[model samples]
Target: MDGARLDQFDRKILSLLQADGRLTNNDLSERVNLSPSQCSRRRQRLEDDGFIKGYRAVLDRDRLGFPLVNVISVTLATHNRDNAQRFADLVAKLPEVQEAHALTGEMDYILKVVTPDLKSLADFVNGVLLPHEAVQHVKTAIVLQTLKETSALPL
Candidate 1:
């Protein structure tokens, strides 16, 4: 598909699903003013078209004992696609790396990490990160407070 052409109904369905993905088909149908079967078909089409990737239950990080959040800036040894993809693949395997971005600036990539405490973060930087051949430098900023956190994407 070139791009997902979203209509009003698609937008509404997406808004409701982002808030609560576990909503029953009947309940969602009622909310969107569509019959259950029609709503199901639309939802299925959306999934197949790649608009709705997957439904998942949100988990509490604090309750899960992962209380620390850190934003890490990393500079790579090179700016080639192979080097970037290699770093990205390594980042994908690290559970603590929640988000990673390739940017057009001094740094190669920025990573948002979540761990239990400073000790774990130290271990990750020393044991896991510094040892990487592609990684040139890393700087970390510990989050004192979180102003906002949301997964909703504007339609």
Candidate 2:
């Protein structure tokens, strides 16, 4: 549904869901001041309309043995559709790459990579990224600390 179509109830539902995706229909209904069935139907509509993509549990990287996080800037050899698509496809297959974004700047793409250690990050950059035909240059910066990190959007 369009943004104009979303009422206060819809907005509240979205806000609550963003904070806690595991909230039950009854709880969400009470928060939004709607009946459970109404809440469920609205939630279903939100999902079908692509506003809510899917639910997933947020995991702690340090606890999961992936403490090292690196932001990598990549420059492609050629700025062509084929090269860009190839690079994107390769990155999608890499489990270490948590996030990748193509940009309109000097660097072709920026990647957020998480690994168990510095050696693993170095190996990924040297072995996989540098060896790619499309990759021209790669610059990496390790994260010292994270002040804040969240996937929630301001509705």
Q: What is the TM-score of each candidate against the true structure?
A: 0.93, 0.98
lDDT of 2 by residue, 1-155 (tens): 69889999999999999999999999998898999999999999999999999999999889999999999999999989999999999999999999999988789899999989999998999999999999999999999999989888878
Whose TM-score is greatest here? 2
Model 2 stretches with alpha carbons more than 4 Å out: none
- Check candidate 2 and list the clashing pairs: none
lDDT of 1 by residue, 1-155 (tens): 43456777778888899899987779888999988888888889889988889988888999999999999999998778888887888999999999999878888788999999999999999888878878989999999999999989976
In the order shown, the candidates' Cα RMSDs to the true structure are 1.5, 0.8
lDDT of each: 0.88, 0.95
Task: Give the candidate number with the greatest lDDT.
Answer: 2
121: Cα error in model 1, Å: 0.5
